[model samples]
Target: MSIPKYNEIMPNILRYLNTNGEQKFRDLEQPLAIEFGLSDAEIIQEYDSGNGTVFLDRISWALSYLTNSGLTERPRRGVYKNTELAQAFLDKPTEEIQIFVKQQMALRTAKQKAEKAEEGQLDESSDLLMENNQTPQEMLNTAHESIRQSTYDQIIDTVLSKTATEFEGLVVKLMERMGYGGQVKNAGTVTQASNDGGIDGIIREDVLGLGKIHIQAKRYAKSNTVGREEVQKFVGALAVAQSNKGVFITTSSYSAGATAYAESLNGTTNLVLINGEQLAKYMYDYSLGMQTKQHIEIKEMDSDFWDGMQNDSKVG
Candidate 1:
C-alpha cells in the first residue's frame, strides 16, 4: 500500500500514543508503517533529494502538528504522549481529526500573518496561507526544487552564450572547485585551443601531478546528441595522452550507443560522462557560476538541552 499522508497519519499518531503511553520518537515509525499497511519498500522510500525517508518526514510533521494543536505533548526529549484534549477525539472519524488539525494550522498561520504584517513584512502570495495537503517540509522541498530547476535552465542558457574557449575554461574552473587538484596552484588548466587535439582541459590530481584527469567539454545545443563516434574519438585522445581517467562533459545528452560504449570500458578505462542537467547540478553544488541570493535556516528544538534540564530537576 502507498504511504499515508501527513494529515492521515495525524489521527493514527494520537491513537498510537494513547494506547502505547509515552513512546520514543523512533519507536513510532515501524508501528505506524504497520498501521498503514505499508510495504517494506514503502517504509524505506526516500525523498527525491535523498535527504530522508518520506515516511519518517511525514510522521515527524504529523507529530509536530498534533503537538501544536495541543492534542499531544512531549513530556521529555524524543518522547510523546497524548493529552486530555486528544482523548476527546480518540474515537472520532479520521476526517474529523484531520479537520481539527487543519483548523488549528490555519489559525496558527493567520496569527503569523498578522505578526508579519505588524512588522511590515506581509507577503500575500506566500505559501504560508496556501491550503494544500503537503506537510510543511514537503512544501519547502517543492519550492527548493522548483528554484533549482529554474537555475539549471539559466545556467545552460548562460553557458551556451559564451565562446568555445570560455566554455573550456568554465569546465576547468568547475573541476578545480570540485577539489580535483587539492589546493595546488594552476592545478586545472584549459589547453591552448589550437594545440589541444581532442582534450579541452586537464586537471592534476595532486601537487606532484602523479595522476592526471583529461576533460573534453562540448558546448552543444540541448537538441544535439553526442554520438558514439564522438565518444570514441575522446577515448582515442585519452589513449594518446596515456591517461586512464577521462571526463566528457557536454551541454547536451549522449546517445544510447555513447552511454553503452562508456560502460563497456568500465574495467579497463574510467570514463565519466556528464550531460547538461548533471553539469548544471554539479556547477550549482560546487557554487560555480552561481551566487547565493538568500539563506533560510530551519531550526528545531534542542532535545539535549531539554533532557538535561529534566535530569537536573530529578537530581535536585
Candidate 2:
C-alpha cells in the first residue's frame, strides 16, 4: 500500500506520542509504519535528496505541522512530546485535525505575504496555502529548481542566436571546462567549416592525445528536431574520420528513431546525443557562461558527535 499522506499521518503521530511519552524523531518510523500497515517497500522508498526514506520525510512533516498547530512540543533536540492540547486532538477525526493545521498554515502564509508586500517586494502569484505542507528545506529546493529552469531557457535562447563558428567555440569551451583538454593548451579546436562532413569540432581525450572526441553541434530552433537522417550523416562523418566516439549536441531534441539509431551503434561506435535541455544543464553545471550569485549550505545536526560530547560532559 502507498504511504499515508502527511495530514493523514498527523493524528497518528500525536496519538503515538500521547501513548509513548517523549520519543526521539528517528525512533518513531518503524512503529508508525507498522501501525499503518505500510509495506517494506513503502517504508524504505527514497527521495532524491537521499537524506532518508520518503516515509520518514512525511512523518517529519506531519510532526512539524502538529507542532505549528500547537498540539506538540519539542522539549529537547529531536525529541517530541504531547502538549496539553495534543491529548484532546488525539481522539479527533483526521479531517478535523487536518483542517486545524491547514488553517494555521494559511495564517502563516498570509502573514508572510503581508510582510513581503509591505517591503514592496514583487513575486509570482503566491499561493494562499500549500496542501502538501513542505518543510523549509524542501521550499528552498523547489525555489532553486525554478530558478535553474529559467536560467536554462535563457541559455538556450542565447546559444541559438550565436553564429556557427561562435557556437562551435562555445562547445569547445564547454568541453574544455569539462576536463577534456586538461594540462594541454589548444587541445580543443573548431573545424571552421560549415559542412565538414557533419563534424564541427574535435577535442583531445587527454594531453597526450591517445583518443579524440569528434563534435557535431546543431544550434536548432525550439521547433526543430534532429532526425535520424541527420544522425546517420553524423555517423558517416565519424566513419570517415575513423573515429569510434562522437558527440552530437543540438539545441533541440532528437526524434525517437534518431535516439534508437544512436543506441543501436553503442558497441561499434559510442554516440552521445545531448538535446537542448541537457545541453543547457551541462553548460550551467560546467559554468560555461554563468556566475555564482549566491551559495547556500544545507547542514544537519551531527547526532553521534553531539551525543558523545554530552556523555563526556556528564562524566566531567
Candidate 3:
C-alpha cells in the first residue's frame, strides 16, 4: 500500500481522537504510527510526494485544526488535552469526524483571514491550508495513486538492490512459472558466449515455437551498481541478438541517472531490470526448481462456510 499524506491522513486522525477516548492527543503520539499504518516506506512515500508522516505532521495538523475551532486544546507547545467541546462530539457518531475536520478548517481559514486583514499580511499557514480545502477529489485521488506507485517503485528498487542473485533468479523463475519454462535458456554463467553481450538467455515465447524473449540476468551487488554504460552495453547486446528487450538484475542500486538513461535510450527495446531481493521472492513464489514446505492456507467463502457464522455473530 502507498503512504497517506497529511491531507489524506487528517480525516483519519480526527476519527481516532474522536473514538479512542482512553487518553488525550498529547499522550498518544507514539501509538499513532501503528494506529495509522505509517511505516518507513510510507514515510518515504509521503516525503517523496511532499506529505507529512501520519504521526507527527498529519496528527498535528488535525489537532491544530480542531483546536482552532474550539474542538481541542493544548496546555503546552507539545501537549494536547481534549476539551469539553471535543467530548461533546463523542456522542455525535463516527460520521461526525468529517464534519469536525471541515468545520475546523473553515473556521481556521476565516480567523486567519481576519488576522491577515489586521496585520496587513496573509498567513502562510492559511494559504498552505486554503489549497488543501479546495483541492478536487480527483486531484487527491491522483496524488494518492502517484504516491503509492512511487512507494512501490522504491520498494522494487530496494528489493533489487538488496537481493542481487536472488531477484534475477525470481524473474527467471517467474517467467518459467508463468509458462516460459524449458523454453527459456539459462546462461552457463548467466549469459551467452557473448550472450549478445547483453542477452543472458532466451525464452521461447511458446513451447516448440521459434519466437523468443532474450534475457539479461545481472546479479548486481551494492559495490557494483548498474550504470548507463552497462545499459548501453546491453543495448548493443540486444542488437547482436536481433532482439529488442532484455532484463537487467541488480542486488545493489541504480543511480537516478542510470534509470533515466535506460528508460530513454532506444524506445524500440523494452529493458527490464530486477535487483536481488526480488529474485528471491520470485523464486519462492514460483517454486520453480525450488522447494519449500512452509505452507499458507487461504480460507474460502464456499458452501458451509457460515457453519459458525450465527454463533460468532451473536457473541460479538
TM-score of 3: 0.41
Instruction: Flag regions of model 2 displaced more than 4 Å.
Output: 1-5, 31-57, 104-132, 297-316
TM-score comparison, 2 vs 3, better candidate: 2
Show model 3 residue runs off by greater than 4 Å. 1-174, 181-196, 207-209, 289-293, 296-316
lDDT of 3 by residue, 187-236 (tens): 12234343245465666665455556666666554477777787778778
In model 2, the Cα lDDT at residue 152 comes to: 98
In the range 217-304, model 2's lDDT, one tens digit per residue, is: 9988988999999999999999999999899999989999999999998579989999999999999988999999998776878988
lDDT of 3: 0.57
TM-score of each: 0.83, 0.81, 0.41
lDDT of each: 0.89, 0.84, 0.57
Clashing pairs in 2: none
User: lDDT tens digits, residues 1-316, model 1?
Assistant: 7888888898889889888898888799999999889999999998886657899988888888888888988776677899999999999999899888778877887887899999999766534532576776778788999999999999999999999999999999999999888878999989998889899999998888889999999999999999999999999999999999999999999999999999999668899999999999999999997899998878777777776763433521
Global Cα lDDT for candidate 2: 0.84
Q: Which number leads on lDDT?
A: 1
Between candidates 1 and 3, the lDDT winner: 1
